[model samples]
Every structure is written in C-alpha cells, then in structure tokens.
Target: MEHYHDRRLVEQTWGSSNAYTGSNYTDYPYFPTLAKQLLPNLRCVQVVEWAPMSDNVYNDGWDLKLKTPDGDGAATAAVASSQLADTSLDCMFVYFDAVDLAGHSSGFSPQNPSYMQALENVDVHVGTVLNALYARPNYANENWLILVITDHGGIGTGHGGITYEERHIWWIGSGSAVAKQQITGPDPGTYNLLGTGIFNQSGVDQAKLKQSPVQADIAVTALHHLIYETGINPETYPFWVGLDGKSWLSQFSGVDKDMERNNIKVFPNPTTGIVTAWFENPTNDHVTATMLDVSGKVVAQHNECSSTNKITLDVSGQPKGMYVLQIKIGEQLLTRKVELK
Candidate 1:
C-alpha cells in the first residue's frame, strides 16, 4: 500500500482527480471536511492527514492551507513502506501535494522546466522510498501489489469534473500474482458480457471473489483480499464487491478441458472425426446445434430440427483439436466444447 499525504493540492495530472474521486464518492471519489471514513475492527489503524499547519491540520472553512511539499510527506511514506516487512498491513496512504502545485503554478509546466518538471521533482522523492523498499531483503517476490489511477483531469491540463475525458484512468499490476496477458476489451462505467466473456483471466478466483465496475470500489476490494490473506478479518467485507481477480496459481492448474465445457458436454474429447454431444436433461422439442472454432465462426450447424429433443453430432471428419458447440434450448443459449483429435 503506497500512501501519501495531501494527495490533492499536488502538482500532477492525477492528484486533483484522485482527490476529487476520494472526496466525492460515498466510499471514494468524494470525501468531505473532517472528512475521513474508517471502519471498526480489533486491529489498530491510524488516520493521518498532512498540512503545513500543525494545529488542527484538517482545519478550514474551505480556506487555503500552507504548502509543505518538501517535508515529512515523502519521508513519512518511505519510512512507512520500510516498516511493512515487520508489520501486517500497517497500511499507509500518503500524498506529496508538491507535484499538483507545481503542475498548476509553474509557467513552463509539463514541458520546458515547466509545471511537469516540478512534478518530476516528486519522482526523486518517490525514488528514494522505492529504492529503500527494493533493498529490503524480505521484500523480493513478496507479492506486493501496485496500482495507480487518475480520478479526474485538471482544467486546461489538470483534473476535476465528471466528463469521460476527466474520468479516464490508468491501471497496472506487478507481481507473480498477475496474468501474463494484458486485458483491454472491457470499457469503464457499466456493461456486462455474459457468455461472450471467456473468463476472469486476470489471476483472481471467482468462487472467492466479486468485481464491481466502479473504480472507487477497488480499494475496499484490495484491502479485503490482503487482510483476509494475512489472517485478519477486516471491519468491512468489500464495500463494492469481492475480488474479480483470479489467482495466478489457477493457471498452473492448467486449462481444464471439461471444466470449461459446462452443462452441455461433449465426450471423446480430442476425438479424431465423429464426436458425440449431449445436452443435460435435453428437451423433446426441436433444437438447433452449432459447431464453431474458438473464434465463434459456425463451422457446422443444425437449424430447426424436426424435433426439439436433440441431435447427435458427427465430427469424425474434422481435424483433431478443439471446437465450440452451441445449442439453442428455447430462448436460452448453451455452449460446450468438442475435440477433434
């Protein structure tokens, strides 16, 4: 968990966006004054916010606070990360508000010794912290997770507001726990693709997981997985959903030919030529059966049979390999796998 202080009021494209998202959403993407959300539990958790003002650091009638981008914000985060090896969670979320400021105020910003340049300065601070963590002997292959996102973009060049352009964010994960291939098909916001989906391939298991489309929900989901794995029951189950993530170990289990076959099963998998297909508790009414390659191209099909009950598929002439079998049981769509080998 990488925590920073005064995350907003920083000098980066994402600072304002992340802040706005955190402050706006009930859970995240929105947080108001006095404004912090905490859960009840047995483990000790501490809440800390940073500001130049020492007295009542969270004070303000929406007033401007002093900018102390150069101090404990970065150092505290680094120190906290080093302590992770010795502690369980001891979670920390810190923000060095300096970059956000530099991004907005600097005249030459982002390009020429400009605002972007000042933002780069924060990298120096981040480097020191990251280097220390990497050096810790206990940290290698620790399954450490990393995520970065921009909630809303700034005006002219920053983040705020609810436009798609503003809401666009980036996500990445690093660890032996991640999937080998990157996923890019699904769009943000709301949408669901049922059978059209292949599976949750990102290396998190479903029987033990749930996923929500809302970005704000990720934090709760992550903490739940982490805390639970660490032998601690978090105060909250996931605020939005369980992990849509899959376990990398699931891959080592390898591809389950029948595991993916589902209710409509085909026998003599890897059969050369004729293969038999059956529907579990099939109907007597006329049904349509289709055979397709993994790409969904219907290489074979039976339309409006005289009877809805079922039909035997003769795949003996086909080459040895894999194929998709689709059946129309009334309005319901069912699919199974067939082997030609």
Candidate 2:
C-alpha cells in the first residue's frame, strides 16, 4: 500500500471532472481488500506499513512490526534488513510511505528534483532488504518470489485522480520464476498484487495463469496453494460471488507461451452494445474467450469455432466500467481491456 488517502480524498483533491473511479479503501467484513481476505489463511505473515501517518502496527493481524523512532524509509528498511533473515517467516508485506510523503511535500512529477531524490532513497532501502534476503542461510533452496509494487502514483503534486500519471503504475516480479523478458499488457491495477502473491506461493504452471489476478482471485489461489502443499481442505469456505481465479492457473509446473501480439484485434472498444473480435489467421485449434469484471467476476464468455474467424460478443446488459477480455488459443493466451459504455 502507498498512501493512506482513500479513493474519494484523492479524487476530491485532484479530479478535474465529475466522473472518477479511483481505488477503493480497505473495508473489512463487507467489501474486504486483499490483505483482509488472505491474511487469515496464511500463517506467520509479517506486515510493516511504515511512515508515521499510515502506521498499521496496531493492527492485530501482523506477526511483526518495526517501530522506527525517526519514522523514515531508512529506519523502516533497516528494521526489515535486520529481520528478513528469519527463516520461519512464510510471507511478508513491506510498505514504504516515504516516497509518497516526499511527493506530497514537494511534487510528484518526475521532473521534480525532490521526487527523484525520494525515489533514489527508496532504491537504496530496497537494496538493503535484498541483500538480507540473499544472505539468508536457506536462500539457495528457498523458492522466493520477490515483487515490488506501489498502490498508485502521484500526478503533479498529489494523486488519487483518474489521470494516467495517477492510475497507471508498474509492478516488478523478480525471482527464479519470473520471466526474463518484459511482461506487457493492459493496466492490471493494484488489486492484482494479492493474487500475484498467492500465485507465487502456489507451484501452479504459468500456462494456466491466464489473466492477471484480482482481489477474490487471491483467496481462491490461496486455497489452491493449501491443497497443493498440505492436503487439508476447508469444508465451509468464505462465500464469495465473484470468479474463482485459481481456475486460470495451469496444473503443471512451467511457464506458458507469451501472447502473440497483433494476432488478435478488438474493435468498437468503449462499446455500447456489440463488440467484434477478429483473429488474424484462421486456425483449427479451439479458442476460448472469457470476460472478467474489475472484481474478478466473469461477465461473459464464448468459445470460437472453426466456422468463422470473427467472434461477436454482447455486453449491452453489463454495467459500464472496465473489463478484461482474455482470448485463449490452446495453451497460449492474450488479454485486452474492454470498456463498456
């Protein structure tokens, strides 16, 4: 997580128009976020949300919290670097809020000298934590999946708006599992971080991991990891109406072929009713098309036939928002963002 500012506050501070779809806040027992859903299932998950403004140490869920007297990125990183050698910890979530604070005080634009300095500071702290991880005794044998991500980016001096500078952010996953090449696709959103963690814990094959994971997908993936590692199964699980994200992961243990760009075309995006998908070349292999909403719920689906190269999908009845379109031709899959207007 980046700043503690909720969606509304960010929009109110930065939005120039009436319409806004900023990230939602963490609400428990109602509209729970990823951390709220995944923590209970995981054992000994460490969490440190430093920066005095967004201190989450008081929360009962965290196994460990670093109390920094200075409340800066250096102090937080020092604590994490010293404590990461503990082999007993299964999962950890470390959030450095210093960069965000720096942006708020100075400016968020990359041209801002202070902003660049703040990022450099973050890099140094991150290096310290990485050094600790590499120095671990079980580092060679451990299947570590290191992911670096931020909740959102700032625009101008602040954030929380729908602008590309604010909403569009990047995530880095480096380890024995991550692909060496650059992973490119539509904006996956911050909610996918939880699902990525669960996917890493699961030794599932990458070929099966089709679209990016959503909040609900994290819970389903965690369930799959539990079943894969330990034979224990929960009889009555949390009742979630959204999609079962785990179904997208492959059962085997290997990466799938990357999506062939320019092979699939979607027309009349931001569509009001009907949308058309055209495949570049006719193939005998079966092609499956699945549409998922922002909440990771399947709204529509279709399987392409050899009868024609063009596939038509109707989303007139669905609500107006962003949706993910996944086209799977055999083991290969490609994703697109569809806006229903």
Candidate 3:
C-alpha cells in the first residue's frame, strides 16, 4: 500500500516526472482534499474519483470508478449515465480530463475552432449525465447540488499565474437550493467556489455568511458542508485551519457583529494547541468561550466568572482541522479562526 501510494504521486501529475529532478516528486504527508476527506468517513457515501490503479478512489474508501477510455468525456458520461439509475448510490463525481489536455495542446480560446469543438463535445456529454440524473428514480425526492467548474483558465497559448485571464473563470451551479438570481460583476476568488456551491446547497444564515478573502477558505467551507450533510461532529478528529482564508460562516458572522466593539483578541492563532483569548473591558460581566467546528458544532466550552477577562482552551489532543472560537461577554459575541495542527 505504501509503495503504491508513493508511485501515485508521480503518475497523477501532468507529466511523467518532475522537470528539475527527472524523477517523481516527493510524496509528502498532507491533508486530504475536501471531497476525499469528508466522503470516505460518511456512512453510505458514494464517491467516484477517476484515476489509475495507484490513484484509485476505492483505495481511499470511495465506492466506485468509471472505466472510461483515456481522456474520453463521452465514454465517462455514458458510464456515469448508466449508473445514475442505481438507487443505492448517494453521490457522484464525473470528471472530463480530455478538455484540459485539449486546452493545453491548443490555445484555450473561444475563438479557437478546436477548442470550441472540444467544449461542444463536453456539452453533449454533460447533457447525457444530466439526463441520467433526471432519470433517477429518486430525482423527485432528492436535493441535488450540481456544480460545474474549471481548475483555471489560460493566457495566450499557456496557463498558470494569477492574471485576470488566468484567475477569472466561470462556475455554474444548478440545484433546488441555488439562488434564482445571477451574481453580477462580483469578483469572487477561486477559493470561494466550492464554499459558494456548498452555501447554495446547504444554507448558512445569510446574515451570518461572510465572504472569505483567502484561498484556503475553501477548506473551511468544505468542512461546513460536510458537517451539514453528514451530521458528524468534527471535534472528535483533528482540527483544520485554512492557511489564509477568512472564516466565511459563524466565526466571521460573530466577528462582523463585534468588530466595532473591539472587545476580544485571539493570539498565537494557527497554534498547535494552547490558545489564549482575552477580552479588553467588561469587568463585571460573565463571559463564555465556546470552540466550534466549521459545521457550528460545539467542540468545547469554558465559562468565566464576572471578574475574569481572559479564557484559555487547550486543543492539543483534538484532530487537525479548522475551528471557530466564539467568545461571549455579556451581550457581545466575538469570534475568530483557530487552527489546531
């Protein structure tokens, strides 16, 4: 298992080996992506992550994989469409890798005839997948969140870098919970894409929603969705802390509410453990500190008597993930992000 895992690190990349080393990149220990992290642990969760044997979904606890021909979106669509009637399956992910290869080979432009043809083919392929989805026996009863996204866009004949042409992309989400109106002229970053999808599916109080400013905010949003869907409390495992993303949920919700008050401060954030949150004034009011996971589940709580202005929480033993620390002093509630690694 270890050897296969190591070999997959190289095979999964765009090229056979690293340009500099002429060998595979090091297989370092890292946290799983949101889809991989949440789906495997959930009971009856059906996932299909496509790749070779070394990078197979089943190896990571996912249920199935489509044996589509290499870079053949039509083949993938057919297989996925065929299985949509299976009532036992709960969730599905169908990826089309051919378009990416086509984009890289030819310039990724709407004007490019080849590129345009490639997109048209994908549209037809996706139509079939949608047809299968609607054909499902439980379609009328199920709440589905269908998301369409591209990793990145290209500039000229190449891609990468955060240029307007590169960073800018389109995302289309259609489902029962998505907003009917279109978002106009809003420049939401890529990190917010999945979170936006989740919000459209599983709602967060709009009054409490805060747009994230960092790329890592997607991780927090993913965790929030997982909790809402699975009803699993994340406090049992390690905590997750997005590297730079702001809290888009209640933590930010409370922060927005209490920002003007400037009553509390959480220092040594992204700490391994042993966090200290201190309040400025309110000498005679009772205070309470609640540590919550992204899903808003309370992991731990501490109560402080009237005279104390500071409360400490130890998160060393908790799993590594993102958490929200909400501090309530009398009437005001202040919240911040806590990363326990």
Best model per lDDT: 2
**Candidate 2 or 1, higher lDDT:** 2
Model 3 lDDT tens row, 244-326: 23223333222221133455788778878788998875456788888877555677888888568789987778789888787
Off by over 4 Å in 1: 1-78, 85-90, 107-109, 163-165, 189-214, 228-341
Q: Using TM-score as the measure, name the better of candidate 1 and candidate 3.
A: 3
Q: In model 1, what is the error at residue 109, expressed in angstroms?
A: 6.6
What is the lDDT, from 0 to 100, of the residue 216 in candidate 1? 38
Question: How many steric overlaps are in each model, in order?
Answer: 60, 2, 8
Computed on alpha carbons, the lDDT of every model, listed in order, comes to 0.41, 0.53, 0.53
With candidate 1 superimposed using the best TM-score fit, by how many Å does residue 299's alpha carbon deviate from the native?
59
Q: What is the lDDT of candidate 3?
A: 0.53
Model 1, 1-94: lDDT tens per residue?
Answer: 1112233422122222333223222122211111121221212222223443223233221222222335424655555455544433423333
TM-score of each: 0.41, 0.49, 0.50
What residue pairs clash in candidate 3, if any at all? Answer: 237-319, 238-319, 238-320, 239-319, 239-320, 239-321, 240-321, 240-322
Candidate 2 local lDDT, 211-268, one digit each (tens): 5432333333333333323211211122233323332122222433222355778889
- Error of model 3, residue 213, in angstroms: 9.7
